[model samples]
Target: MDLTTYAILLAGALAGGFVSGLSGFGTAVMALGIWLYILPPAIAVPLVLICSVSSQISTLPSMWKVLDFKLAGPFVAGGLVGMPIGALLVARADPQNFKLSVGVMLLVFPTALYFIRKPMAFRFGGRPADAAIGFAGGILGGLAGLSGPLPTLWASIRGWTKDQRRGVFQIFNGSVLGAALILQIASGFVKWDVFWLAMLALPGTLIGARLGMRTYHALNDRNFYDVVLALLFLSGIGLVWSSIAPR
Candidate 1:
């Protein structure tokens, strides 16, 4: 990639990493938005995965204490089962239609969260429900390179403490991202070019994540949610617009 492309990718990584560090989600949305404009979706997805996983690792040390392994475990298991299917769908499916579907889903998320005030707990009714959510998350993860929002929403409804929510989300994302990278490699979606780009973005990712963590500590819960909601809404609109506009 040229200097301009590299610059763009680095900027996106910084922005996405910061968001992920603060909110435990939004890295993919932030990075993918710019990356897709520069690279094919297939390559963009994997590249974003690489950066995201790296950021998660950086934040893992601090988040370990609050990590909800029990809740994360089942969701990850389901993601593993679902990702391969999503990969296949992405490979064969029409890009436009898939974008439209993803856009609709993105739009629906904030709306549902807005209206649904009843908070639920994270404890699954059973293994089946846990597995089901994982499967769904994995499928979406593989296809759109975004699977955290669904599980994050689920966790939020459960009234998880902020730290617990962050820990659960980071673990879930890290696992799915690892699996998705492997599948993408096997499927030939991951290329040397993309790998290089991800490597180039690593420094920025680390810096951004640390900065975000600092910022997160400074913000109150209400302020944090306000920021996250605004970002999510804006990112959703961007995705929807990119889906409809002529390529």
Candidate 2:
């Protein structure tokens, strides 16, 4: 990669890592956007996988105490089953259709958040609901790397505490994303030329996670939720625009 490309990758990694550290997601969206400008979407996806795994592993330790392991299993199981299918679809999908779909999702997600009432406590509707949400997350993750929002929506409906929600979601993402990365690697989506880029971004990921934990402690529950919603909306729009105007 040229110096300009290296700069873009580094900047994207730092920004994405910081956001994810604070919110438990968005690293892939951020990195993918920058990389898409310099690489094919197929290559961008695996590169994103590498970056996400690095970021999540760094963040997982501090948040480990807050993770809801019981709820994570079903979600992981469903994601493992569904992600490959989504990947297959992405491999064959028209780029224009992908942009349109992302645009629609961007417009819909924030509005959906506004209507949902937060529950008083954590409510797992049983294994069925868990499995269903997991499956939904996996499919979306595979197709667009946008799976975090679905589970976040479910968690919001159940009224999980901010730490609990973030921790659980990270665990869920780590499991599903780890598997997806393996598939992506096998398909040769990850390029050797970018391996160093992924490694170089690791420090940013670590810094971001630490900052995020601090931010999580500083914000009240309501403010934290609001911030997450806003990030989701903005990132969705950014992804849609990137796919459409990819420069």
Candidate 3:
């Protein structure tokens, strides 16, 4: 590949890893948004999947104690069913339209959440509701490499404590992203270019994740959330611009 591709991969990896390490998700939101500027969705999606796994693993030790298997189970189960369908759709999807749709979601989802601020709490907290959201997340994960939005929103709506929210987000994303990587491999999407890109990205993922975790420990909950929203809004704008710009 050319220097441009290499530069994009490295830059995306570093930024994505830092965001995900700090927030328990948003690796794809940051990475894929930038990657889509140069790489097609097929390549960009799988690359994010691989790097997401790296980020998750690096930070696993920090959040290990807080994980609640019971709380994360329903979402994991639903994602198992939804991911393959999304992968199939990815294979057939129109590249420009898919990129545009993802860009729109990136822009709209964060903006809506920012404006809604302190949404009415969901009282039920039912397994079924969690599962439904997970299913949506899985489909998005499979299609555009974005599975964290629904779960993140749900966790916020539930008003979970920081540890509680981290537990759910990390576990759910770890499971789904791992599965997505495997599916991509089976579908012949993980080739040499992706492998080399991933290799070059490893250090950035490691370094950024370490820094992010430190930041996560220092920030207050409200401030952390604000930072995440700002990042999402910016990433969304990047994707939108990439979708419309000339190749």
Question: Which rank order by TM-score, best down to worst?
Answer: 3, 1, 2
Clashing pairs in 1: 78-134, 78-135, 79-134, 120-157, 120-158
Write the residue-wise lDDT of candidate 1 on 90-197 in tens digits: 778776666667667767876767665554555656657766877888887888678776776566566666776677678888888778878888878788988877
- How far out, in Å, is residue 28 in model 2? 1.9
| Candidate 3 local lDDT, 167-189, one digit each (tens) | 78789899988998898899897
Q: Which runs in model 3 stand beyond 4 Å of their true positions?
A: 1-4
TM-score of model 1 (CA atoms): 0.88
For model 1, the stretches where C-alpha displacement exceeds 4 angstroms are 115-127
Best candidate per lDDT, number?
A: 3
Structural RMSD, model 2: 2.5
Which RMSD does model 3 reach against the true structure?
Answer: 1.8
After superposition, candidate 2 runs with Cα above 4 Å error: 115-125
- What's the lDDT of the predicted structure labeled candidate 1? 0.76
Number of clashing residue pairs in every model?
5, 2, 0
Clashes of 1: 5
Candidate 1, position 191, lDDT: 83
